[model samples]
Target: MKAIKVAILDLYDGHPNQGMRGFKEILDRYKAKHNLNLVYQVFDVRGKAEVPDLNFDAYISSGGPGSPVDSEGSVWEQRYWELIDKITACNQQADSVKKHVFFVCHSFQLMCRRLQLGEISLRHSPSFGVLPVHQTALGRQEVIFEGLHDPFYAVDSRSWQVTHPDEDNLKKYGAVLLAIEKERPYVDYPRAMMAIRFNDYFFGTQFHPEANPVGMKAHLINEEKKQQVISEHGERKYDEMIERLEDPGMIRLTQSTMIPNFLDQAILSMQEA
Candidate 1:
């Protein structure tokens, strides 16, 4: 077996987060369980402006706190965009072994903007919960979502969203909008894009599929986070989210399905190449 190299881009800076833990746990578990010949490393993108070279076969960019838009033109953003561009160009070569990328929330927002996939903007209200996500025609056919139901649930905690699909741009790049946020009958706004296949080698979700609900619930139940959620989303929502976090049918299903499936496919593609 050829050794497979994976680079994890940490966007959380220095702030405390469950996302980093979630990624490492999933990777560690997958590696041990499969006994695959793989090695992974992490680079602090925002705090240190550190980005990986093109040596890795795959990359997973984690979600971070704050607006993806406001950070435009920052030093870190420039370096990050260069990495995206390089990998994109690398995949364009017919004979080169492909490089796969999976973008989480904050990184997904930036990817949408960079690719002109949609309108990147703030939501009327921040979305934070174990929310249901609906699939598109394309999404239903995606291998990454296999074994997952149409209206699956995942952790969505963000103020910015990728909304209003730009059909022409998507067509121009051969990208397909995959999944979207569950409709809000009373909101009178287009559903935000929850997932997209940016290309054959690139995939992303506007929610955190790698979130460990157990860890997340522990974070939320803290006195400060509990009150904060209640203040922002209401007591009822807070309680519902807390309950759903521990449910096997909700985030646990998603947690076990999505990212693991993505890595499975990515590793297979690497070996075949």
Candidate 2:
């Protein structure tokens, strides 16, 4: 049996987080269910400047805590970019089995900046809740988002957003803006890009697709986090999010779909090749 190698780039920078736990749960489930020879290794990209070599079938870069804008020219950022460059080069080859990548949250923000796909800037206020993201036309046809509701809910906690996409670069890279935050009819503000297909082998989401409702609810119920949500997003919003956590049609549906679907597609393609 051929081994399926996966590289997990940890960008959390030592902050305690549920994202890494979420990733582990999903990956473990998939590996067992498929009964495949799949192995994954973690590289602490931000904390230790550690990066994986171009010897893996797929890579998943995790979300982190910091400004994606301020990390430019840093050692870790440079090394990360170098890995991406190598992946891009390898994928461009006709004979090579292409490498797959999925960027989440903060990593998604950095990808937007790196690809010059959008303006990465601070939000008017922090967005911290399980919110609906409406899919674009291309997103509807996207394999990873297949069978997902047009307006699916996912956990979105970020101090920054990607807005005002550059049309030329998007076309140049053959990248499709997959999804966006729910439109505010009353506000004259640009909707943040919630997802983007960077290329055939590369995809990303601004929300945490690995965030299962049970885990999300657990995090929310933490006293400090509970107060933070109530203070920033409002008490009613916090209560509403709590209520929605158990809804089968909300974040649960999203968590079960996106990341798992991406893995299915990648694994199948690589195995077939």
Candidate 3:
């Protein structure tokens, strides 16, 4: 058996914090399972102005707190968009058709905007803790959702989420909405699109399945201002938020199952494509 090379793309390269570290741990665990060669590469999309032409079997775009629509935002780096466009082109091409890309959190925001699956507006913002998503028929059948019953998962902390996943977005992007979590209209956006799959090779999730128990707590305690924001408008109260953040079972399942499940899907997509 040959090792599958994977690149975990981190937008916040130098800052070692909860989001980046959790993604690193996820890559580590997946690499342990098979002949998986994993590389953690950080990039400042603004500084670099583009995504690197790194030759690897798979690419995993890690989560970031920033929005892709911001002029000074993370994925706005020309190279990042270049890579995404290239991957999407590969998906569209008939002759050169082997590519796999996974986007987490804000990374998914970039993908959605580029693919025209959803729009990025500054209307409503989402914050941390365990969110329950109602799984679509496609999500239940997808390999990425394997062994998951409740269809809800806890993500550490994120500032943005999809406001609307209309049919127009879905058709234009060639994406199937996998799951969604309902939210109130005023503070949090309704029709929040939590998960989607363009195909077997390209997948995006609004939730951070990469986060673990330890990391989530560190995030809440560290980002106090963000905590206050969550406290003010988020559905979960402060203590309840923390309790879900540190849920042992969810953490274990995320690490041991969902993360690995994503890696496995990437590997399969690469081999099949």
Among residues 3 or more apart in sequence or in different chains, the pairs in candidate 2 whose N, CA or C atoms overlap within 3 Å are none
Candidate lDDT (C-alpha), each: 0.92, 0.91, 0.67
Instruction: Name the candidate, 1 or 2, with the larger lDDT value.
Output: 1
- Provide the lowest-lDDT 10-residue window in model 3: 45-54
Clashing pairs in model 3, backbone N/Cα/C closer than 3 A:
50-79, 51-79, 51-80
Q: How many backbone clashes does candidate 3 have?
A: 3
* Model 2 Cα lDDT, one tens digit per residue, 75-179: 999999999999999989888888899999999999999889999989888888889999998888888988788888999889999999899999999999999
How does each model score on TM-score?
Answer: 0.97, 0.97, 0.81
Error of 3 at 195 (Å): 0.8
lDDT of 1 by residue, 116-175 (tens): 889998888899899999999989999999989889999998989899999999999899
Clashes of each: 0, 0, 3
Error of 3 at 28 (Å): 1.1
Give one digit per residue, the lDDT tens place, for model 3 in 1-273.
655666667765445556667767877776776646665565555445435464666777877655667743444456676786777676677765366777887778877776667666653444655666668887788777787765566563566666666687687656799887744567543666778897657888887777777766665666774567466766355567677666665655655666677777666756766
Return the lDDT, model 3, position 224. 75
After the best TM-score superposition of candidate 1, give how far the Cα of residue 218 lies from its true spot, in angstroms. 1.2
Report the candidate with higher lDDT, 1 versus 3.
1
Query: What does candidate 1 score on TM?
Result: 0.97
Give candidate 2 regions above 4 Å deviation.
none
The global Cα lDDT (0 to 1) of model 3 is 0.67
